[model samples]
Target chain A: MDQFTLNLIVVGITFALYIGIAIWARAGTTAEFYAAGQGVHPVLNGMATGADWMSAASFISMAGIIALAPAGGYEQSAYLMGWTGGYVLLALLLAPYLRKFGKFTVPEFIGDRFYSGGARLLAVICLIVISVTYVIGQMRGVGVTFSRFLEVSTDTGLYIGAAIVFAYAVLGGMKGITYTQVAQYVVLIIAYTIPAIFISLQLTGAFLPQLGLIGTHTASGVEFLTKLDQVVTELGFRAYTSDSPNMLNMFLFTMSLMIGTAGLPHVIIRFFTVPKVSDARTSAGWALVFIALLYTVAPAVGAMARLNLTTTMWPAAEQGNALDGPAITLAEIDSNPELSWIRTWEKTGLLGMSDLNGDGQIQYFAEPPAVTAANKALAAATAALAAAGPDADRAALLAEVAAATAARDAALAEATIGGVSLAERGWVGNEVTRLDNDMMVLANPEIAALPGWVIALVAAGAVAAALSTAAGLLLAISSAISHDLIKGSINPNISEKGELLAARIAMTFAILVATYLGLNPPGFAAQVVALAFGLAAATIFPALMMGIFSKRINKEGAIAGMLVGLIFTGVYIFLYKGWFFIPGTNMLADIPANYLFGISPLSIGSVGAVLNFAAAFLVSGMTREPPHEVQELVESIRVPRGAGSATGH
Target chain B: MADKSSANAYWAANLRTIGISLVVWFLCSFGLGIILRPALRGIHVGGADLGFWFAQNGSIYVFIVLIFVYAWRMNRLDLEHGVEE
Candidate 1:
């Protein structure tokens, strides 16, 4: 079969399976739809959580980002650190309490805790913010992967993706999604690991796979990482495994992802599907095990991809000459159709190359800025400032300026060896990005000349990654709308059937809004994704933890703390990102240069979390304790024994 | 013995597990991973800082151990206190 047909078949089979599972597992009642009738096996729930948690970011892009960046190992470590760490909070603090409260949704718990409808409403709003922002990104990811592999327009891909999601999720409810997600988990992890194993064997000569990462480069006595650092630095970039410019920011950014991972509604809800609290604990461990399989392999994939690209760029003997064959010319892309993602993406203006020095080919290089470039009219001006009238010392300093500018300009001009410039590649040591981090993974397989099956595996992985997360987010959004908004607030007398219908309607509308945002993603969508973690950490995480752990905290205090955390994090991000991150309206570009105390906008969410804890604690001190009755409830939530399956009202 | 403090024993057993698990969680997450990272810099495993491993892999492994340990100990305690199913 033709490659496209083969890809179509693979995707078709997976979709059919999902739909079939949905049909087989259609939820019969409100209980079944909302919490899978609280009968899901802990192990199975862990698998579903794995699929839910491993969004497009984890499955589709993480390894690529790691592979393509030189500082990938240590810098990108937050992807591992924060994501896994958040579970500590979830498994220990939040899961059991929420499960015991036996609410249909997060906002329900918030409402009961605060003794105010407004507090519940406030929580629902945060849920919408975090979930919608998260879902839209997943939708966009699905569109792109489908467009490329399925040979359809992004809109068509989205429409089909939406329909497939609706069939299983809307019809199947949590039970359907649960079993299908187990299937998806299998598909996704297999697709993810197979490619990793192939790449590892090709690179390291080891088959145990994980150990292959640290296995020596058999031909070269030098360690693989040492060789990588040398090669990247030679091309004018930071060494792989070296620190990023903003270490503290990276740390905070990582922490935000961790806390966010725990706070995400889809992930947190999975724990509740199981029958008991002890089961919940074991399930979390399994979920981590499933996640760790990929997490551990990701760095190796990143390292190998970097090596692969560098080696491809310079197929000749090391250090023989800086320029190898020839850098990729515009004509090559113009002539060949397959080499088009670069050219097509360049129009987005994130990627660009112009003939500098009037070179016929795009001589991309890692070059310094105008201030550093010498002769370099700017450099000459600086030389003039440093000049003593015609003195030899002045001449030497001028020469030094020229030499420095030469180096800087060479760095500034994305370096071209032969046909490939270091800047054109992912791992070039030092240059501002002109490409989305997502592109690195997309480009690597093609760069490596992997077989069609391997390429097809990547396609399936991307779709699965996108679909799994989309289903999870859709479920979260729908539950919030139907369970919290309708049953809890708008129509408390709504029948079970009415609530189920409302949930289906909510999901359909959510898919549409998510689709619209995917196409017209806000400027800071990627940055906002990381920010979702922060919001979850700061606002929702604290409230959930306090609700179960501290009986003395009154509804008023928890409400006040959540409101403070939510508004503060939102405003802080908005002030720099814009009013709602409205591209040009940003008060300042929310980068390290413009940040408060160099705490990256990404990491500021951690501060927000801390503030939430403080505000809640301090505010609680001023309020009367929850009724003594509340203290007993808190005690009941902490223990695993004596609690049976909670029937949600 | 007087009453065997059935209620307190059951709650206490649960609390002991939570307390122990929390300590391990703190030590693995904030302790070795972040705060003690500087102190443990000299310790390296397979090219990464020992703290890095603890943060990334080791701590998670420890969490699993702590959890299983908690489950077993809690199960035993629960039966002793006549709380287990």
Candidate 2:
């Protein structure tokens, strides 16, 4: 069978399975709609949380970023560490206490704990903003996966994804979503692991991808890291195993991601579906174990994918010529059976090529001027310093030039002709300049020449990851609007049936908004989503932490702190990301050199969090203490006994 | 007065456990992974350095272990404080 037909069958079966689970676990009551009747077993909730937490970005885009090391370095591993590490904060500090509080929604807890309607409303606003921003990325993820694997336009793909999420979420609510997510987690992990294991065995003769990552390549017998370090340096990129250029930024970025992970409302709400505080803690651990299964193997997958891509394009020639193999001519791309994957991916336009100098052959290499100029300059500088006296500055310059020369020589050796300089030769510029980072995982199986069903399984896995996250975010948004906004603030007398209807309506509206954003994504949409992290870190995490940890904080203090955090982080992000993300309206440059205290806008969330803690403490010191009953309530949540049941209304 | 004192004592014990665990968490991720990364690079594991291992995989493993320890120890602490669910 053809690849297209196989992809359709696999993706179709997965969708049918999701819909079947949704129908079987259809929610009837308001309680079931909101918190799955608060009866989810710890392990089941952990599996559901795993699906919820590993969004399209984690499953699809992260490994690509790690492999590509875009903008030069492996610093993007902060995302891996920060995201996973944040769960520790959630599991240990936040989850049990919030579960003990027995609230239906995150905002409801904030409102009740602070004893203020306004605080509840503010939390609702924050939750809506975070979830909505997050869902846009998921929608885009669904669109990308569908367009590539199923051969549809991005918009049609998004609509298809939106419809699937709506059917399951609107009918079954949290109950249906919980079960579907479990199936999704299983599907995604298998899809992710199978390709990785296959690729690992192919590259290194190791069964486990994790071991393969650090083992010797079977063909070259070179340590995987050593081989990769040679390849990337030859291509003018940093080594795969090198340290981040800026340690401080890596440290802060990881911290921001960790706390931001804890603060995200969709993830926190998953714990509320479990029965007890103890279950909340256990579930968090299980979720990590599930998440780690992917996390540990990702680095291996990334390295192996990078190596495979390099070997395919610039294969190690049979005659031991390391520099250039017989180039794959344009005509051969269409005719060569082994080269069919290239033609297939090229149709999606993510993988593109053009003969720059009208040469029939494709030359995927570092730009000539960039490689030679740095090499010549460093060589001249080193010679000059060596001629001078042995001063401290000269010694430092010597060391720097030594590394640069070594890297340049590796490139030169690869591009060497029989005494002919690469510049003197006429060759096309790097033919593949548009390698989108998100394409790495999707294209891995095809690149490695895996069977069609494995590729099909990858397609299903991408869809599952996107759909599971989209459902969780939609649930969070709907709960906020129906439970926090309409019932808690606008209409306290709303009946259970009325609230359920409102929840479904809110979900429909949220899906539409997310689809619209996915279709017409703004230029700064990526940066703006980072702002969502900043807002979550600044507002929700601090407010939730203070509510539990401090008895002195009053309603006025909580409201004041959240407002300050919300506005401060929001305005700072808007200033650089364009006013409200409007194109061509940014007041300051978004680069690190332009940031306050050398913190990039992406890492500014951690700074916003510190400001939040400081502002809350100051505000609470000046305000009245919480009422005696509220203080006792804090005490009760602190201990694990007498936990109230999580109710729907 | 005695009941209030005991409750404070239980909270303190809980805080101590949290503090100690958090310290280990910080050491593994931020300390060993980032700040102390270069220092740990001299130590090799398999084909990679310790810092890269910590950043990519070790910290995640530590995080999972830490949560289970916190859960198991906290549950025992709850029972001892007469607050078991």
Candidate 3:
């Protein structure tokens, strides 16, 4: 069978499996719907959490981002460390205590802990906004995967994805999502690792990508990173191992992602499903083990993919003679079987090339500085020629033009590759113009010439990653609406059956909103990720940490802190990313020079978090302490003893 | 239930463990990975320096180990303090 049919069979089977799991594990009560009946095995819950946490961005886009980072990809380690490091915080600082709290939702814990309906309502709003924004990204990722693999329109793909998530999430709730996510984790991890293992064996003669990353390339006999550094620097990029110039920004960005990861409602809620506080602790470890399996391989995949792409463009680079040889010719690109992946991806419009010098060969190199200077001189001479008009010193002007042309040629000659002038070789500019970062992972197997099944598995894996996270986020949003908003406050008299029904209705409504947003995706979908992470890091994380760790933090303090963190982080992001991400509304350009203390909006969350902690402490010190029972409640959650099933009230 | 003084001691031990673990976490990720990276330029790990390895790979391994260690130690603490579920 062809690639499409293979993708269809693979993706269809996975979809059937998820729907089957949903049917098998259909939730029966408010408890089951919200926290998977509080009976999930630690390992299985960890696996499910792995699937829930590693969204399409992790599976499909993370390695790509690392591979294509303009500054040699080393600085992108922020993402690698930041994302996983948060699990450390989760396992240690948050998970065990939250599990012991025996709550159905985060807002429930916040409301009761703070002893205020207002605090719970604020948390519900924060949870909804964060999860909703996050789910939209997942839906878009699903659409991209389906459109690329199944040949469906993005809208149709989104509707199909929404339907699948609705069947699983709305039907089975957390129980269904938990089991399906375990299966998803299995599929995605297999899909991710198989390619890396194959590519590792192909490139470095090491089957293990983690070892292969540091191993010597078989053909070049150079260390993998050394070869990568040499090749990329030859093409005018910084060395692959170069450090980021702004250490503070890197620090804050990593911190933001770390805090954000721990704070995300969808991820935190997974802990509530576990049987014991101690189980919650180890479950985090298992989740990290599963997550680390991919995270460790990702850098290797990125480095190897970059080397592969660079070598494909400059075939001689593999032999350590790139400068002495010609770039890949258009004829070879057109007819070489190994290069067919380029053409196939070109059809998706995410990858493209243009031959500006018309030499029929792609001269993929950074423009030499001399050529830039020469171009400037040529432009000046041309303007002078035009200014002379028809009468004044026409021949002199012509001579000036000739001199400028000669000068440009001389400069081009001085700028040589392997002592051969670019002008002599008739090469002008880079040709591989549009390499979308997503291609690094999605097109990876194709680039390595892996089998059709592997490619199909990748497609299925990307869809699974997207769908699993979407389901998890949808569950979080619906539970917040139904459990926190409605039953907790709006209708204190609501029956358990009525709450379950309301949860299902809220889930359906959430799916509709997510699908609509996915279909119409605001132009600022990418920009709003900063908002999701920022608000989560600034507001929810601080509140939860204080609620569990500090008995003195009162409702007044918690409310004040969350509001301060929310508005500060939100407005800061809006100032740089446009007000509420609306186009052309930014007060300042989103650049380092304009940043506060060189902290980019993406990194401002850490600062917001610090400010939140300060505000909470200050306000609490100035105001009355939490009630005696609230302090005792804090004391109780601190221990692992007597933790029972998740309770609504 | 454990007495208030025993509870306080348990909490302090837990805090100490967390503090120690966090120090390791910060040292690996931020110290060797970022600020102290240049200082460790002489120590090589395969192709890159130890700092680069820590940043991209080693810190994650440490984090995984740290969590399991914390869990194991805390489990023991819970049992010793008669707080085990």
Candidate 4:
């Protein structure tokens, strides 16, 4: 069967499974809506948490980011490190304590711990900001996956996704979101691994991608990394395994992501679904285990995809296959059945090519701006020499130009397989300017000539990942509005049934808002997620930590800390990336040259967190101490004894 | 007889364990994985250098182990101090 129909069947089956799980696990009360009645098993909760935590960024974008390293260094490893490391912080420092607090939402914990309506309101604002920013990315991801696999318009794809999530999440609440997420985790992991295994076997004669990454190339018998290093460097880019140019930025970026991961309200609330404090800790471990199954394989997928992409454009004749004889020409890319994936992606406008010198050959290389300038300068010099009198040593000047061109050309020829230059390739500018890095993974199986079913599975997996995380985030947003805002504050006397209705309404509103943003996404929705992580790391994380770990931190201090942290991180990001990310409204140019203390906006959250700690401590020193009862509450939460049941108050 | 002193002792033990475990976690990701990565560059494993391995894979492994160890040891401490749930 063709890919589109197969994709529909696979995606349809997964959607039906999700809806079935949602109906079976439907929430019956406000508590179930908020916390799944707190009866979920540790392993199950862990799997759900994995699904919630690994958003579109984790599934569709992360490996591509790590692989492309658009920043041209290994700095992207920070995502790999920081994201998983946050779970460590959660499991040890935050999750058990929060679970013990027996709360419905993160803001409620802050509200109760601080003993102030103002503090609770502040926490709610922060949660909404972080979650809303994050949900946009998930929504955009859903649109992309829908558009690609289902062959619908981005808007149509988004509405379909929003409708599916609305059905499951509104009906099931936390219970629905949790069980569906488990199914998603299973689907996403299998979908992720199958392709990696196939590609690994083809590339290195190893079935395990992790082992394959470190193994030798089956055809060339060279170690994979060594071959990769040689290939990328030949294209004038840094070696595949090289370190980032700025170590400090990488460190801070990783730290921020880790802290942010721990503080995300949706992820933190997952631990509350499990029964006991110890279970929260164990669930985090299980979550990490499931997460690691993909995280560990991601680098292998990244490296192998990078290798495969380059090799596809520049076939390796040394392997001596019939298709390995020449670099891909523009005409062949359009006509060759083997090159059909390129045509499919090109229609999305994410991939494009041009024969700048009219050479009719695709020249994929690095430092295009530099090469173009140098080539122009050489041509001009040669022309001027020819324009000079015949007495001028034109022969020598021409020879010098020829030699320079040959040297430049030699790199591509030596680095690629078969050493064949497609039509004197050196003068050609980089053929493809619109090679969207995000398309790498989705296009990988097709590039490697894997079977259509595996490609269909990838479509299902990407949608599952985006939907699962979107459901979790929508749940958080709805709960915050219902549990923390309306029920907790506006109408304390609201009935349980009334609150459940409010929760569903809140969820529907959140989905509509998310769908609208997904349709007209703020530029590069994923980058906005960095701002979300920053906000969470800076404001929410410190507040939660101080509320648990310190008795002296008063309500005034917590509120002050959150405001200071939020403004600090928000302004820093806005100053660099536009004001509220409105494109051209940035105060400073978004470049490393203008960064504060050499810290990029991506890494500024760590600094904001430190500033929060300092501000909270300093402010608390000036204010009266927390009330005696609040102090007692803190002390009680610190221990695991007599942890109250999550149901029936 | 599990009064304030015993409660205080239990908290102290938990804090101590947390402190030590956090130290190990820090060393694994930031220390060995990033700062000390350059020093370990010559040490090869599979296809990557030791530092790259630590950054991409080893630190995560260590984090999972650290959390489980913290939970198990803290549970034992809780029992010793008569604070088990």
**TM-scores of the models, in the order given:** 0.84, 0.89, 0.90, 0.90
Worst 10 residues of 3 chain A by lDDT: A521-530
Candidate lDDT (C-alpha), each: 0.68, 0.79, 0.83, 0.80
Range of the 10 consecutive residues with the lowest summed lDDT in candidate 2 chain A: A521-530
Query: Candidate 2, after superposition: displacement of residue A398 in Å?
Result: 45
- Top DockQ model: 3
TM-score of chain A in every predicted structure:
0.84, 0.88, 0.89, 0.88
**Candidate 4 residue runs with Cα over 4 Å from true position:** A152-156, A166-175, A317-325, A371-426, A494-505, A519-526, A647-649
Looking at model 1 chain A, report the run of 10 residues with the lowest lDDT sum. Answer: A424-433
Model 3 agreement with the true structure over A506-525: per-residue lDDT tens digits: 88887887777667543223
TM-score of model 2's chain A, to 2 decimals?
A: 0.88
**Listed models, DockQ each:** 0.35, 0.59, 0.83, 0.67
Supply candidate 1's per-residue lDDT for A552.
Answer: 74
* Worst 10-residue lDDT window, candidate 4 chain A: A414-423
**What would the per-residue lDDT of candidate 1 be over residues A134-249, giving only the tens digit for each residue?**
77667766665666676666566666666666765576546666788888888888877777777767766776456665565544555555666666665555666665556677
Q: How many backbone clashes does candidate 1 have?
A: 25
- What fraction of native interface contacts does model 2 preserve? 0.77
Chain A TM-score for model 3, please?
0.89
Which candidate, 1 or 4, would have the higher DockQ against the true structure? 4
Alpha-carbon runs more than 4 Å astray in model 3 = A151-175, A367-427, A493-531
Residue B34's C-alpha lDDT in candidate 2?
82
Model 1 misplaced stretches (Cα beyond 4 Å): A68-72, A151-175, A317-365, A371-434, A520-527, B1-16, B19-23, B26-44, B47-60
Tens-place lDDT per residue, model 2, A373-450, is: 656766687777777765557767777788776766555545634345454555524677567666788899988989
